[model samples]
Target: MATTVRRTSITLPAAHLGEENPLPALRTPADPHQVHERDRAGLPADMARQIGYAPLRSLLPVRRLDGYDRHRTPTDLDAIVIENDRLRATVLPGLGGRVYSLVHKSTGRELLYRNPVLQPADFGLAGAWFSGGIEWNIGATGHTTLCCAPVHAARVPAPDGGEMLRLWEWERLRDLPFQVDLWLPEDAEFLLVGVRIRNPHHRPAPVYWWSNTAVTESPDTRVIVPAEEAWHFGYQRSLRRVPVPRWQGADRTYPVRGERPADYFYEVPDSARKWIAALDGEGHGLVQTSTDQLRGRKLFLWGNGPASQRWQRWLTEPGTDGYIEIQAGLARTQLEHLRMEPVSELSWLEAYGPLSTDPDAAHGTDWTAARDAVARGLEAALPRSYVEEAYRAWLASADTEPREILAAGSGWGALEVLHGRFKLPGTPFDEATLGEEQRPWVELLHNGRLPTGSLDVPPGPTLVAAHWRELLETAQADALVEYHLGVAQWHAGDRAQAVRSWERSLKAAESCWVVRCLAVADAESGHPKRAAERYLRAFALAVESGQGDTVLGALAREAVPALLAAGRAEDAETMLGALAPGVRRRGRFRLLAAQVLLALGDVSGARGVFDAGFEVDDLAEGEETLSETWFAVAERLVAGSGPVTETVRSRARAQHPVPDAYAFQPE
Candidate 1:
């Protein structure tokens, strides 16, 4: 059969992606994998500039997605499939346009690591990301906030006169629009993905894009890339160059040899083909090769340490085999953001398929031999010239309008386009897609003011880009107007103006949103005590009005932590006590309760939490809070009423090993 596209479903035990947390992400998720100041001591000028360019200070406009709990049901998720005669690719249109499965029809072999469940962890920039097949990471440094959100998907004409699946969305972080088109030609074994990132604005924008592919990993699996050295980044917060395949006295080619989670950004020479592959012991697995525009290749793996082992189980079912990540991006490292010029875009074509190479050469200790063997094999299957030709061919049909709409994304893109009068072709953000989130903003656009609403419920989603900021600034000052303007100003780096706007909004009406934002500003300004007080006030107001909604309960999660940080432990406990029974039972709040108990010197109460066994459903990839709290509880227990000093803490860590469930993150 020729290539075709159709809508389908994939059944899995999926944690319901609960409502977006009402709390604004005033701080980005802390990443120890990022480069440190010391890491820049010896870099070239261009590399240094790119690495340090446009790091995100906070995730404004976007809210944290921590409302999900440890609950899963057998659900039939919305999916789209692209099929050819030889291969079948399953995509999740409702959830980030992820390619969930790619199957080789003849061998019935799953080319990618098809995740058994749709379990979301706190991995993306805006939170709630899952581990699986192939995910396109766009926007800023971390995984895109759009990971759990929907994207506009449609059926478009392919380069080969066939239909292809196209996914597009407006990336809010850097205010750019991007599209990914998946195409399969007649009788072709390879899947071709054409990606385009556009800087529609007149000014330059920092861009980040990575096509991350997860493949089944084993001890004998060898990764082949065309590079002699790589820019290695570890959780140690350092980025330094090291020899490929044999770094730190281990054959880094094998995922099992890695001692800790790290990223190896291969320093591929300018003349080489851009590709990466992970072949099994017998030399058959997945290969990902992209055009020269997507020049960077990388390998990321969860190392074989105790922490890695625990994390492996946490991401999926326990005892399931782990997976390795081989990615292609526009920059040398995930830490760097490429600068896309005004009105210009970076486009590339990527191919994915099954590859079988000489097992002896691929698995050999000689890195050159192994990489060369795969490189030659890839050339035989699909050449660099052919990839370039395919990219040009796809570019020819890039402006072809969608034949049919498969799925709908957020209306933010439509809102932006309508406001800015942007003329983008091929990808249309139809006015029909606008929903409740954009209603007030839409009013502000046409009516010269936002519609006022009740102060009790959470305000509509905040729009913080420059264009939205201009509208909010001139709109008639009201509680909602000022509050949203403050968010926009904060996002624009005008802290003084943001604070003034918030203060003015509060003078008009009492709103939990404005107060919480003020509290965050206070905390960031080093007024911790005032921040804590404001946080409590915000939470109390939300509770009194929202009646313990899951969204409102999220503010409590922030308030208690703030109280404890301000050395008001007793206040933290009291705040926790006020929570409804159902709210307290949430895994996140249960964990917080333990911390509160510990702060109140109730060691036994804290210990009871662990004894009962609790799992934080959205525990992050590198987060070690579970183990930290466990040890703190252990230290208190070991001290026997004495003050738990450093020596006592050492004894606790030495004697009371954390149980498997909570044990993640290397010491």
Candidate 2:
């Protein structure tokens, strides 16, 4: 079956369709008390504290453009359309090179959710994330920072006798490059998606890649995964595995009418064929099939409720509805659990298209039948062996262990920590050491690895701490070394030593991480005042560094308790007020700010923040949302039917039964 594929350019009206609004300048209120003052003997001191400011000025300069513009004006933007005999797909190269829409030509049905308007939400780490379509998320935590930005796109020569659309982007944090190639073979029904992530940096870096596909959610929409169990992080950061289809006494495989917003990560089985599908009652829906390289399939849903409705309305225009996310990840679990080595490339092949099962056949429970049907459909488009071979080659090239790579390349046989450096016995130590030479050691320490791949050695933390102390003798001026040394000490249960090291690290370099470490140590050491001050400093530094909402949220989570314990409710309110409007817009931070208000006995103010936070549409499950204590307090505050002051007092008293300091574990 020879099919012909064609590519064409098209333009569509921008989201607002008829408005021009300029984005506001990023700024925050500077503390009035922060003024220049001299020490006792008329000696000058630096008094301009660098807290409570926006950090996006350097990374994301204000730009005015039509396609994928932040303002969502009526400007027209260019797009690429590729079509075969059975399917049609549109690519928005200007908007993160997203697969804007995919449709079945014969039925005129949308296979991928298509947003009628382009509305950016404060959901991503870098603040702007759009709903609908398929988004490629890589690097950092949560959604990729580039979700709302443009990607390099080109028409590339296809070696497999098809029309290809190539999209590539350089990930800033990891200094790595990744590309996604979409190929539409002549007469083929499925679209071939080939992804390649390459690390050109000198050392290993944390890597997380997920292809987020949004599909229409309906009453009969059932998400089927070829797995028996799914794992999700619970309220206490513990991973819990539950039975597939039904979890917690409820059938999760299908969309229930009144279910709460949930997220589930299904671990792929070791079967020869792997596939995930969203089939409707009528047996017609979308199917995503991939090789073994992609080991995790995630389902995210915002259930039908007040919160979900409000959130959907915030992200899309009126008359438009919300969709569910079917994500595929390269790692076995979440992004926080994966890493990649330098000079290594990861490749995987995925195919997506509309699928129709026999109306008479039982679709949900027949795993073997479903697999065979998917395999047959895929074979109709391309040979299964081709994808298998591609995956095998990728596995062969993958450098699975950073330790092995470092040992083989740098001759740094089993890593041993020294002060802030790795002691490779004969390796020369100098002041101007290259980051390449130092990266492997940092990765080992950062990931908490021991030499010889053995677990019965000396206490890992103590061993690392001793080595870090040794490195400090020579690298005393290095703030990073001091920070890591502090971490090692903290892990070794030496809070006093950790605090001292972090204090020195703070003096050498005003980093968010260092300040945060000091804050935790101070809190645990029973110095609430010092802890509150350090938390404020850390919050300011995180904002200035554009570290995003997670860091800001974490700071708030730790700081609020310390502030309340220190009886500094006024200070907490002031800190919350100082946050930029952009930062306050994030749901996580907004929730924290509301909690701070509740702590200050301002119920109305807390309610306002809570109301605003619900406007952000995000299906991802977070620790804050799962907190039993926080929600109990929030419910009372939102309902306006409790002795608020006593409630706050009680919650505060029960405050942090779990050590809040350990929450600052470096990612």
Candidate 3:
């Protein structure tokens, strides 16, 4: 039996109705210092020789146009539609080529959440990340640096008589290539997403890939993963493996009631097939299925509270009506735990579609039963025999140790293997199992002394430094250790040493964190020009990689000041000019840009910037709105006020304080 796939192009309403989206362009600057290959002693030999240390010398910020493009108007955009008898998928080629929506023909219901408006929020490290649909994230952590950016997309001929939509982009930091192919077969219930990541360099690079699906969250929405236990961390000291659905007196399978948020990553049980689903009370839902290659399933909850609801509204227009993310990862955990070998190609296939339970059994237990019933439906769709064959093939292709550890169980043993490979020390295991001699180091590593983004336990910078040095003696190749060491030094006020440590960290593995720290060190140490360059590089990396909003916002806070101090007023203006008017008008960046305009003697320009800033809606609660400073500056800059003086500008700058460079650390 042959399956036929059809591809057609259609115009659909844009995400941001009656709004404007301006594209920003930036160029990679030439390195100033004549750094040689030998200068990069900390880097892998092959990679060091290939790129040398030239770009490391003087990194510059990206250049933006004089002002945002107001001439361009919003209109219905073209989308590539691929369909079969059972399912139809629509992809927006211009908007990161994300899966805009998937429709199940039998039910005529959306399998993926579709955003009514394209209202990008300050969520991604790259400045703006939109909600809804399935976003393919790759390269660096938090969301691939390109979540809200455009990628090269095309409709290609599939080898199996179906049409394939291919989207690809080259990651700037590591020069790696990533591609995703979406296709559907005739009479097939699911749409398959095939992803390929290739590392072209001669040395291994840190790589991560996840497909984040946004689905409607209702009071009855429940998440189901075929895992007996889950590991919970983030915003807490106790990170342990516990039973799924119900753990530590909290039922995590369903959303909780409160302002406090809950986020956890579950390692899928060793099975022939792995699946995760978000089911409604009616036993109807969306299910994601993949082979053993994709074993990590994560659930994120925003909780039912006033603050969470407000945040939801701020992130998307018309809101998602409330939504949750069911993300599937290729690695055992997050990106910090995974790496891609040089010149190697990694590929995997995942299916997403609608699933429903038997109508006769709907009135049984509760939402939990509905979830189980949906899981059963998925199991029947892909039989055990078929899953077993796929799992065996995947095991054959995977490396030896990871495969063995996964086979053993999903607990500390697998985590120990990954930690040993990455040279990270903390295992979160029972301390009773350790010998007396190794107990103190383990205690220091696992003790509650480690900072978990809390003010209660003031960070032990000195203690952290000592522990990292001890680990470095044994695990010299671990780049993350150097990163932590640099963080400790920066906190300890050894700015020069911190910069040196970050330089070594970059050689081992290039990350945006190291670059950002270097920028801070340069700024605080009185090298404003160098700091400007570094901040620009960090911003470029974030923009290139599609980082979350926190990182981008931090970079803006640091870069604008450094550029102004370096007397690069025009450059500062250009950078601010590139941002979406909405982004530029909010937060500290708006005030900072206005000060720069005033400093340059463009009083009218400064007034215009201030007026635009006032037009934006107030930021949501808990956000860094810097309202006091904005208001104070606004009072002084208003139309009838006297000419602004340097003192007034200085006072405004003091109000909006910059955060510590390492504030946006990867967990």
Best by lDDT: 1
For residues 278-337, could you state the per-residue lDDT of candidate 3 as single tens digits? 877787889998766787788777766554655676555543477888888875444232
Each candidate's lDDT (Cα)? 0.87, 0.57, 0.56
Q: Rank the candidates by TM-score, best first.
A: 1, 2, 3
Instruction: Put the candidates in lDDT order, highest first.
Output: 1, 2, 3
Question: What's the alpha carbon RMSD for model 2?
Answer: 15.4
TM for candidate 3 is 0.57
Clashing pairs in 2: 3-186, 3-187, 418-467, 418-471, 419-467, 419-468, 419-469, 419-471
RMSD (Å) of each candidate, 1 decimal: 1.3, 15.4, 17.2
lDDT of 2 by residue, 93-194 (tens): 666778889989989989998887677654665545778888888864466766766565555545454446666655643445677767667766777787
Write candidate 1's Cα lDDT for 154-174 as tens digits: 999998899899999998888
Error of 2 at 559 (Å): 8.9
Return the lDDT, model 1, position 525.
92
| Count of backbone clashes, every candidate in sequence | 0, 8, 13
Worst 10 residues of 1 by lDDT: 546-555
Best by TM-score: 1
